[model samples]
Target: MKKQNQKAWFFVLPVLLLVAFNALIPMMTVVNYSVQETFGNNLFFWEGLGWFEKLLRSERFHAALGRQFMFTGMILAIEVPLGVIIALSMPRSGFWVPVCLVLMALPMLIPWNVVGAMWNIFTLPDIGLLGYLMNHVLGIDYNMTQDPFAAWATIIVMDVWHWTSLVVLLSYAGLVSIPEAYYQAARIDGASNWSVFRHIQLPKMKQVLTIAILLRFMDSFNIYTEPFVLTGGGPGNATTLLSIDLVKIALGQFDLGPAAAMSLIYFVITLFVSWLFYTLMTKDDE
Candidate 1:
């Protein structure tokens, strides 16, 4: 047993080294930059806690953080249940299973920028199917460029379309992996559909649901490209998430110190929340 456990470490060692080189080194550099002020030509001055303090008090940061949380919460709430329902409705044993899975996976395979650009063209009010139907047929002002609510709605809908497939796939995997014996036993006991699902399917799916929730939360919280390409963080600052605002500060405004500090804070918050989610999701098992 000891030798087998020791052999497993060899498989993990390469990955650990790669992560250290690629992720940890860059992260430490960012931490260093976050604490120092730099002038042009490689001049740096100690400015410990200054940038962090400023970001903590900044109204823009507060607003962006609030919007980020709201978007992530809304996404998880909507996607999780919807994905589960879709998964449950899908055929359990059929030749169509592979076809359905491939179709579901298609969206997630597209490049992020392409997804954004495609949506941009597809939502044009003149030629776009959705835009024309919503604005003209429904008699609603649905232009994302001019209206804040419209912009928000478009972004949310686009995100749901893009990412709900991930949850669906994961849930479907969990559902399919459940042994037929469990269903047989449930049937023998005269279990109703709801009871079987509640007692067996839902519990078995907890791990995958936890993965879906964490992935969606982190992705939504850190979302930038789609919204940036779609709205450029605005028709005003209505869609400026924390990640977008951080990029704006770092590149657009050349505020490296503050942006670095904010990035560190962003990383910390994500890590903390993810750990909490893992704990909560796994606690019942113990």
Candidate 2:
């Protein structure tokens, strides 16, 4: 019998300890807060499931959750197909590949808060370039602050601009990994472009696309900063996603029990939906 190496356990132990400290401890603290009401410093009262029950029945929670779903659904619908199309259009080789990749990655390189602030300034009705163009040159009423429709459009557009690049990069990676022999074989068989894509490209890219969909879904569902900075959840709660609403409850209203319950609920929903997506997408493989 050969002796197994035990030294690797030492390397993994520190990471496990770090995760327990950072994630597990905080999670336990949230769980504690969820079941108990805090009146002030060192004062707590058991609330049991009251907060969870209340939140489940709350209209505000429902509305925010609905908006979150809508946002995530729209993001996945737009980004996945657009990313694939952009990837397909990209050059397989030569001078433009690096340039195009860099450009696609540029939006993603910016910090999330900066992206929000940048768009906020870029869409100001008076001084902003796009705003001026729409209002003056194009003669359009495009104030996101006052109009719900405009607000939705602006946030959606902003998200697409910022995140579609992730999908594009993933799709491009999938595309480039395809062996040239597949194309050669397709040509030998006189396969049409559509046929080639359907039979070869789409199948090969399915895994990456699945990854892209899940990532976009989670990010869009939990998104807070950009939309908050851009619309402040108004004109009147038009874009108050669940995360934003959770923060409003936790910080703004200072409701610890309810906020903790909502946080747990939000986390569970995300985890369950992501699992569902992954299972459905990969079921055919199994």
Question: lDDT tens digits, residues 13-59, model 1?
Answer: 99999999999998998998899997789888999999999899999
Give the count of colliding residue pairs in each prediction.
Answer: 0, 0
TM value for model 1: 0.92
Error of 1 at 171 (Å): 0.7
Model 2 misplacement above 4 A: 1-12
Provide the overall lDDT of each model, using Cα atoms, as 2-decimal numbers. Answer: 0.90, 0.93
RMSD of each: 3.5, 2.5
TM-score of each: 0.92, 0.95
Model 1 sits at a Cα RMSD from the real structure of 3.5
Show pairs that collide, candidate 1.
Answer: none
Q: How far is 248's C-alpha from truth in model 1 (Å)? A: 0.4
